[model samples]
Target: MFEPGRLHLEHSPVQPPDVAYELIITYAPASSQDGPSMHFQVTGHIAGQPVDESFDLAADLAFNFASSIDHLARRHGLPATQVVPISLHRQYDEMFADIQHKLGRHCGDPVDARHLGKT
Candidate 1:
């Protein structure tokens, strides 16, 4: 799980000094067992202009953070790079499963039937 904190972006030659980006995440309970959805709020400055946006991801899709970031980067015309390294695919999968397990425990329910295929 990504800790809720300021994510220090890597220094890349393509990144402009005038642009600063930050991501804030929050979780909220939902009416369905497949919920307790996650919200990602991306805020930043681009060319001295403020930019902000939020995306709500259901629990089933919450593990696809890298893809979400790629889409966000594309929307902003920024470079889209793999957030998870290929070598870490196994670790990422384990971590995602752990998150699902913990969420189930905390929410007092099993994983949703619709998501059984995903696991």
Candidate 2:
């Protein structure tokens, strides 16, 4: 569900299966001298245990999901709207790197898109 100015992805252990990596993303974008940055906090469960994490929310999502983003943004009447091109695939790659850096678990090779409910 998308609220006033936030986008949310909801899921439960029952939905994600065994490992139970369920996450909710709450983020806002910011324009800085360095570059654009997004602040996001994710709270959920990993293997049925609490997993709390945060990061500079880099824009990431499947191309097919753009309409979802637009829907939310329009619903909220967000201003200064602009379409910024970014590579979701690359962001996903970095996500694993960030996950490893923060979780102390190498999330490469072992994480299959098939297991993630993706083809």
Candidate 3:
């Protein structure tokens, strides 16, 4: 559930990926803070709700998104799944974690969520 900077890609030929998509590995420089925080955020339709997040550079935040989607797909019997690259808007580590907490779920492990292949 993310769309990269619409302006950033305006001049580029490739169109953005679809929702529940994954962008190729790309990085936006940290902001001008003393040491700007690095993060991963998701904003768009996901798992029956909108999702957004930010995380430290090393936290593999992207992986979490994919895992979460995977679980949801399995649970809901979606026909397909994909990973779209993400966009950044400066640093907001606390905000990202907050959103995750509000979701009250971690898209980790799927063995139990998928029963009889029907989530």
Q: Write the per-residue lDDT of candidate 1 for residues 6-31, one digit (tens) a residue.
A: 22232223444323333333333243
Q: Per-prediction TM-score, please?
A: 0.48, 0.36, 0.25
**Clash pairs of candidate 2?**
38-57
Top candidate, metric lDDT: 1
The runs of at least 3 residues in candidate 1 whose Cα sits more than 4 Å from the true structure, single-residue gaps closed, are 14-34, 45-50, 80-102, 105-119
Model 2 TM-score relative to the real fold: 0.36
Model 3: pairs clashing at backbone N, Cα or C within 3 Å: 21-83, 21-84, 22-83, 22-84, 22-85, 23-84, 23-85, 41-53, 54-96
- Candidates 2 and 3 compared by TM-score, better number: 2
What ordering of candidates by TM-score runs from best to worst? Answer: 1, 2, 3
Best by TM-score: 1
lDDT of 3: 0.31
The CA lDDT of each predicted structure is 0.46, 0.37, 0.31
What CA root-mean-square deviation does each model show from the true structure?
Answer: 6.6, 16.6, 13.6
lDDT per residue as tens, model 3, 1-119: 22231111111124343233222222232332323323433333433443333333322232233344344434433234332211242222333444344333245623233222221
Error of 3 at 15 (Å): 21
Residue 19 deviation, candidate 1, in Å? Answer: 9.1
Per-candidate count of clashing residue pairs (backbone under 3 Å): 0, 1, 9
Per-residue alpha-carbon lDDT of candidate 2 for residues 9-110, written as tens digits (9 for 90 to 100): 433333322232344545555443434444555555434556454445222222223333333333332223322111233343444344334333432323
lDDT agreement of model 2 with the native: 0.37
